[model samples]
Target: MARSTTDSSSSGSSSSSSSSSSSSSSSSSGSSSSSGCHFHYVIGDKIDKYVITKYLCSGTFGMVLEVIDEQGIPYAVKVIRLIFRS
Candidate 1:
């Protein structure tokens, strides 16, 4: 039997029905033609913690940083600049 290549939807415990694409990614893009897609989204908004410590680098893109959370755990956040146009 041949493996099917269709996106299957799933739901989280929160009753949220977001997408978890099976092959939209170049990681496995075959069926559909991608004009060009960029995946970027708000990060810390989901956490409600952490503080950005210092600006690490910014280029044609936006910014990066060294951050510390409420638990004193350090992390790096890369906030992209312009919205990607496909």
Candidate 2:
């Protein structure tokens, strides 16, 4: 897969530099764990080659995010949280 670098500053937030890979893998800007697992992804977060643009919505199971590819093509991705029993 191809990799690309993006300017996080475009999202209007100041953060450390990060790179993105061209793959279908899932990622997040950050995450937090409480009763279950919650993933927090912000705008400009590069997951694969797509940059998160807007947060569509979230449910008890997961969330839908609006992202755009390097070519400016928009797409929606669903992030699901898995619960593990020990």
Candidate 3:
């Protein structure tokens, strides 16, 4: 991510020299938001790229997808209930 550097020494404050604090902030006046499936516990694409390895189980009952978690850990994802449908 590209960042714009601004001089804040003119204010004469103790935090004027904090580099790390200013880098992550947006200097421009803009709006930012995330578009994801808000209903589900699944964090969507932003949660460290959870790769769907396979299904743990599947039948007329429901389905369970085995996935690699954020830390590359394995987990069983079973659809216990239908929270929302569309």
Candidate 2: worst-modelled 10 consecutive residues by lDDT: 8-17
For all predicted structures, in order, the TM-scores are 0.38, 0.54, 0.33
Whole-model Cα lDDT of every candidate shown, in order: 0.33, 0.52, 0.32
Residue pairs in steric clash, candidate 3?
Answer: none
TM-score of 1: 0.38
lDDT of residue 31 for candidate 2: 56
Off-target runs (Cα >4 Å) in candidate 3 are 1-49, 80-86
Minimal lDDT window, size 10, model 1: 1-10
Clashing residue pairs found in predicted model 2: none
**Model 3 over residues 1-86: C-alpha lDDT tens digits?**
01111210111221332322333322221111221112133323222345444433334434443445456544444444333557
Candidate 2 on 1-86: residue-level lDDT in tens?
12322222132212211222232334444355531336666568777778887655456876555667788755555566766779
Instruction: Write the residue-wise lDDT of candidate 1 on 1-86 in tens digits.
Output: 11111121111121111121232222211111221213232323333455434333334554433445576545544444436468
Decide which is better by lDDT, 1 or 2.
2
| Candidate 1 Cα lDDT to native | 0.33
Clashing pairs in 1: none
Superposed on all Cα atoms, the candidates' RMSDs to the truth, in angstroms, are 16.2, 12.3, 20.3
